[model samples]
Target chain A: MPRGQPPLSLPALIYEPKVRGIIFQVLLLAALVVAAWSLASNVAVNLQRQNIASGFGFLDRTAGFEISQQLIDFKPTDNYGRAFVVGLLNTLLVAGLGIVFATILGFTVGVARLSSNWIVSRLALAFVEVVRNMPPLLTLFLVYFAAIKTLPGPRQSIELPLSSFLNVRGLYMPKPQWLDGSSTIVVAFIAGIIASMLLARWARQRQVATGQQVPIFWPSLGLVLGLPLLAFMIAGQPVAFEYPALKGFNFSGGMVVQPEFIALLFGLTVYTAAFIAEIVRAGISGVPKGQKEAAAALGLSAGQSMRLVVLPQAMRIVIPPLTNQFLNLTKNSSLAVAIGYPDLVSVFAGTVLNNTNQAIECILITMGVYLVLSIVTSIGMNMFNARMALVER
Target chain B: MDAGIRNRRIAITTAALLAVAAGPAMAQTKTLDTVKARGTLNCGVNTGLAGFSMPDDKGQWTGLDVDLCRAVAAAVFKDATKVKYVPLTAKERFTALQSGEVDMLSRNTTWTMSRDTSAGLSFVGVNYFDGQGFMVKKSLGLKSAKELDGATICVQTGTTTELNVTDFFRANKLNYKPVVFEKLDETVAAYNSGRCDAFTSDHSQLYSERLKSPKPDDNVVLPDVISKEPLGPAVRQGDSGWGNVVRWAHFAMVNAEELGVTSKTVDEMQASANPEIRRLLGKEGDFGKGMGLDNDWAYQIVKQVGNYGEAFDRNVGAGSRLNIARGQNALWTKGGLQYGMPIR
Candidate 1:
C-alpha cells in the first residue's frame, strides 16, 4: 500500500515460490543433519562408555574358522577380509547358476501352458501353482530334507549316463582336466569364432547386394567347430577327462557338486521359475492376436509366425518383469543358510559374527555387499531393457 | 493480519504441549523404589533346555536354572510363587536384560570376558561348570575326537560354542568344516540327517539333545573336553545393587548346600544350635539387609528351591537321564571347583 518506489524488496523476493521452496528444503536438510549428528554422538558416547571398539580394523584379524563351501582357496588362517570375498563369490555363483536354470524352466513351462493339448497346459499350470504357493524356506527344507537326503550314500551311488554318480554325498561327474597346450587350443577356438562371425556378415551383405543366397550356416558351424577340433589335434589333444570313481568309502578324482549346492539351487530355481512363468505368460498374452493372423496371411506357418512376428515383441514386454524375478532369485540365495550352505550371509555374517563377536561390523559389511550387488544387477538389466525397447522413427 | 498472528501463537502453544506429552516416562530414577514396593520379581529364562531350563508337561518350569531364578524371587519376596518367568533365546537374552524386560537372566549363559566387558552385562556367579565337546554317531566308530579329522561339524550360530569348536580344532592342528545353523534344533536335525559328521556344543547340551533324539543310544559323545564353559546368571551392567543381589542369591544356595542344609530340613536347621546355621538361616542377624531383602530371605530361598546340590541332582545329576556325575560342579570342600562365599 506504500507509495514508495520500493516496498520491501527482500521480503517480496523471499515470498516467491522458488525462494520459499529452497528455504523450506534447506531448513528440512539442516534439521535432518542435526538429528543425525545427535544420534551419532549418542551412539559414540554409549560405545565409549562400554569400551567397545568401533572401526574397520578388525577386518585384518584372522578369521579362525573354516567355510563349508568355497569357490576360491581359503583357510582358517586367512584374514576376515579374504573370507568375505570368498563368501561373496559363492553367493554370486549360486545366483548366476540359479538364473540360468530358472530361465530355461520358466520359458519352457510358459510355452507349455499355451500348448494346444489340455494335459500339457494343465500340468504347467499346476507346477506354477504348487511352487509359488509355498514359502521359499519350506521349499528349501523339502529339497534338502526329502529329496537330497533320501539319496543313497557313496557305496550305493546311483550310476547315471556319461559316468556320473548321484548320491547323498554329492553328484560326482567327470571333470575336464586341461592338459599342457590347452591354452593354445582355447585361443584358436576363440579365433575361429571371430572368423566365422566375420564370414557370416560378409555372406549376408553379399546376399543382400547380389540377390543370390549363400549357404553360410553350415560353413560357419564347421569353421567354429572343426577349427577347434583341428587345433586340439595339432596340440596333441590337450584335454583329458577325470572320471569320478568310488574309492574305499567315498568318491574321488572328480568334481563333486555338494548336496548343499544342489538343494539351494533346486529351491531357488523352482521358486523363481514359478513367478517367471507367470510373467512370461502375461507377456505372451500381451502380444496381440492380430500380429499372428497377419503373419499367417503373409503365408507364414504357425511356428514361423510366432518366431518372426510375435516373440520379438513379446520379449520386449517380458524382459522388464523377468529382470525383477532375477533380482529376487539373487536375494533369495541367502536362504541357503537354512540348509547349511556357506552363502555370504551364512559364512561371513552369521558365523563370522559369532566367532569375532563383531555383530555390527559383520552385518553392515554383508548388507553392503548385497546392496552393491542389487544395484549392479538393476543397472545392468536396465541397460539391457533399454537396448531391447522399441525405437520409434 | 493480527488475527493470523494470534492463530500462529496458539499453534506454537499446542506444539509445545504435544512435545511435553510425547516426552519419555522420566521414571528411571525411581526403578529401585518401584521394585522394592512390588512383591514379585520378573526373571528371564531359557525357553527349553531339558536339564537347564524347560517347562514340564504341567507347564511348570522345573530345571536347575529355573530353580535358581525361583530362589532369587523367594529370597526377595519370601514366596516362590512371586516369580514370573520370561522365556528368551540366545539372541534376545541380552537385549531383554538391557531393556529391563526382566530383572535378571538365569539362563545357562557362559560368562566370557568379552561379554562381561563389551556386552553391557554383568555375570552374577558361575552356577554350573561345563565344557565344549563333540558327539558322533556310534556307527562311525569314532573312539576319540581326534579321529574326526576333516569332518563336517554341525554347530549353532550366535553362541560361543562355534568359536570354541573352531579354536579347539585349530589348536589340535585338525581340519574341520563347520555346518552352522541359526537354531540348535536345526543343527541337531542336520547332524541326525547325516548332513554333518559330528555335532559340537556344550557337553550338557549334548546330553540333553541325546535324550531328545529318537534313538539316544545310537549316538555317543566323545570323552575329550575341549574348552572350559562356566555357565551362570547375568544382569545388566551399571546396576551393581541388582547384580549383588543375584550373586548372593546363588551364593546362598551353594553355601546352604555346603552346610548340610536342604529345602526339607531348613526349618530344623534354623532351630539348630550352630552359629553358622543361625546366621545363614537369618535367625540371628541382618545379613539380608545388605542385599536389600528381608532378614528371613536366605531361609525362604533355601526352603523354596532347595540347596544347589539338590537342584542339580533333580535336573542333570547322577539320577537324571543325563546321568552326569558331580565332577567339577561339586563343592570345593569335596575337591571340586564350586566354592561359595560364607553366608556370614
Candidate 2:
C-alpha cells in the first residue's frame, strides 16, 4: 500500500469523513442526554414546587376504595399494589378471551367473504364495513346501553337454562363448588391433554413412515374426554353446583358476571374482528393459485385443499398483521374506564392515580406496563412467525 | 478510541448537570402574574352536572360552582364574563389544577385531608354542605340506606363518595356491591336502567341527576346521609398570593350575604353608614391590596356576580329546577356552618 508523505494536521482530521462522523454522533448523543435529563428534572422540580407527592411509595398504602370486578381476592382494606394486580389480571382475562374469540370469528368471516354463495359473502362484507367504520368507543357505548336497556330488572329477570338468571344487573349462573377430591379430577384432565398430544405425534410419525395412515382422532378424543370422566367418578363426584338463589334485593350465592364486562368484551371482539377479517382475507388470497390446483389434482376435496394446502402458507402472512390487531385490542381494553369494567387503566390508573395524586409515577408505571406487555406479545408472535416461515432448503 | 469515549462522557455529564440545575429556576414563576398576563382566569368546573356546572345551548356555563369561578374572575378582572371555564371530570380535576392548566378548580370537589395536604391544593372554604345519600326507585318500598343490604350500588369513582359507600356498608354490617364509574352521567344512566339497586352521590348531585332521568318522579332519594361532603373550590398550593385572592373572593360573597347585600342592593349598600358594610364594600379599607387585587374587588363580585345567597338561590335553590333547600349551607346566624372569616 502507498503511504502518505506527511501526517495530517488538525483541520484535515476534522474534515476527514471517519473523524467527522464520530464527532457528530457523539454530539448528537450528548444533546439527547441533555434533553432527556432536563425533561425529567423539570417534572421533578414542578412536582416538588407544587408539594405533590412523587415516587412508588404510595403503592403500599391502603387503597380505601372498592372495585366492582376483581379477578383475585381484594377489598377496600387491601393495599394499592394488590389492587393493581387485580386490575392487571382483569385486563388480561378480557384481552385473552377477546383474542381467542376474535381470531375464530375473523377467520370464519374471512372465509365466508370469499365463498361462492352470494348471501354469505354479502353478509360478511356488510359486517366488516359497518363495524370497522364506527369508533370502538361508540360501539362500546351502544353495546352497554343496549345491554342495560333491553334486559329486565332483577325482580323480573329472565330465567335461563341451568337455573341461571339474566337481568340488567348481570347474568347470574350456578358456581361450581370444589370438594376435597376436586384436585384429583383436575390432575386427570391435565394428564389426558398430555396423552392426547403424544398420541397425535405418534400418528403423524406413522403416516410419514408408511403410506398407510392410522386413525388418531377418535382415540385421542376418547383419551381426552374419557380420562377426565373416569377420574371424576373415582373421586366420588367431588364438585357440586351452587345454584343462584333470589334473595331480598337480588340473587345471592352464585357466579355473577357483570354487564360491564360483557359489553366491553363484546365491543372489543366485534370491532377488532372486522379488521382481522380483512387481514385474514388478504392472507388467504396471497397464496399462489397453483397450490390449490395441485391439492385438487391429488384427489383432495375443496375443504381439504383449503385447510391442508392453502391455510399453512397463509399463516405466515397472517401472523404479523394479526399481532398488531392483538396489541390494539389490548390497548383498547383501557376504554373499560368509560364503562366501569375495573381493568388496569380503569381501577389502577384512574382510581389509584387520583387517590395518590402521584400523576408522574402512576402514569409512568402504567405506560411501562403496556410497553412490556406489547413487547412480550411481539416476541411471542415473532417466534411463531419464524417457525411458520418458509424453509431455506 | 478510549480518549474519544472519555471526552464524550465528560461532555454528557456536564450537559446533564447544567440541565438539572435549570429546573428549579424554571419552576419559580408566580401564578398570579401569569393569570394577570393572560387577562382571563382559567377556572376548572365539572364537565356537566345540573345546577352545579352545566352549559346551555350557547355554551354559557351556569351553576353554583360556576358562580364561584365568576366571583373570583370579577374580583380579579372586575368583569364577571372574563372567565374561561375548563370542564373536567372527577378523575382529572386535581391534576388539572396542580399542573397549572387551570388557575383554580371550582368543581364540586370534596375537601379531604389528602387533597389539601398531599394533592397540592388548598381548599378555600365549603361552598356547598352536602352529604352522600342513596337514590332508589320509589316503588322499591325502601325507607333507609340500611335496607339496601344485598344491593348493587352505582357510584362515580375518584371522589370521596366511593370510599364513603364502602365505609358505610362495612360499618352497618351489610352486604353490598359497588359498581364504580368515572363519570356522573354514566353512573346515573346505569341506575336509571335498573343496572344498580341504588345510585349514591352527594345529595345535591342525586337531586341534580334525578332531574336528568327519563321519569324524575319515579325515583326517591333516601334520607340517609352516609358521609359529610364539604364541596368547595380549590387552588394550587405554594401560591399563597393566588390562594388568598380565591379564598377572599369566596369570603367576600359570604360576608355580603351576612351583611344583607344582594346584587340589586349592592350599589345602595355601598353608600350605607354602617362601618362593617362600608369596609366590606371597599369604602373603608384597602383589603384587596393584601391579596394583589383591585380595591373594588369585593364590590365587583357583589355587583356583578351577586352575593352567596343570590348565587345559591339562582343556581340550586328555589329559583332553579333543582330547588335544593339550604340545610347546613345556610349562614351561621341561621344555625348553619357557612361562617365567613372576618374581613378585618
Candidate 1 global CA lDDT score: 0.80
Q: Give the best candidate by lDDT.
A: 2
Which portions of model 2 show Cα errors greater than 4 Å? A1-23, B1-27
lDDT of 1 by residue, A141-234 (tens): 8888785458886667899998999987778899999999999878887988999899988888998999676888798888888888998999
Per-candidate chain B TM: 0.90, 0.92
Give DockQ: model 1.
Answer: 0.22
What lDDT tens digits, residue by residue, belong to model 1 across residues B259-341? 88999999888789988889988888899887778888889988999899998899999868778889999999998988889
User: Candidate 2 residues B1-344, lDDT tens each?
Assistant: 12343244334333433433345653367788888899999999998999989997788999999999999889989999999998877877776676567889999999999998888898988899999999999999999999999899998878888888889988998878888788788888888988899999999999998898999999999999989899998987877888888888899999999999999999988789998899898888889887888788999999999999999999999999999988898999999899988888
Clash totals for all candidate models: 0, 0
RMSD of 1: 7.8
Per-candidate TM-scores read 0.88, 0.95
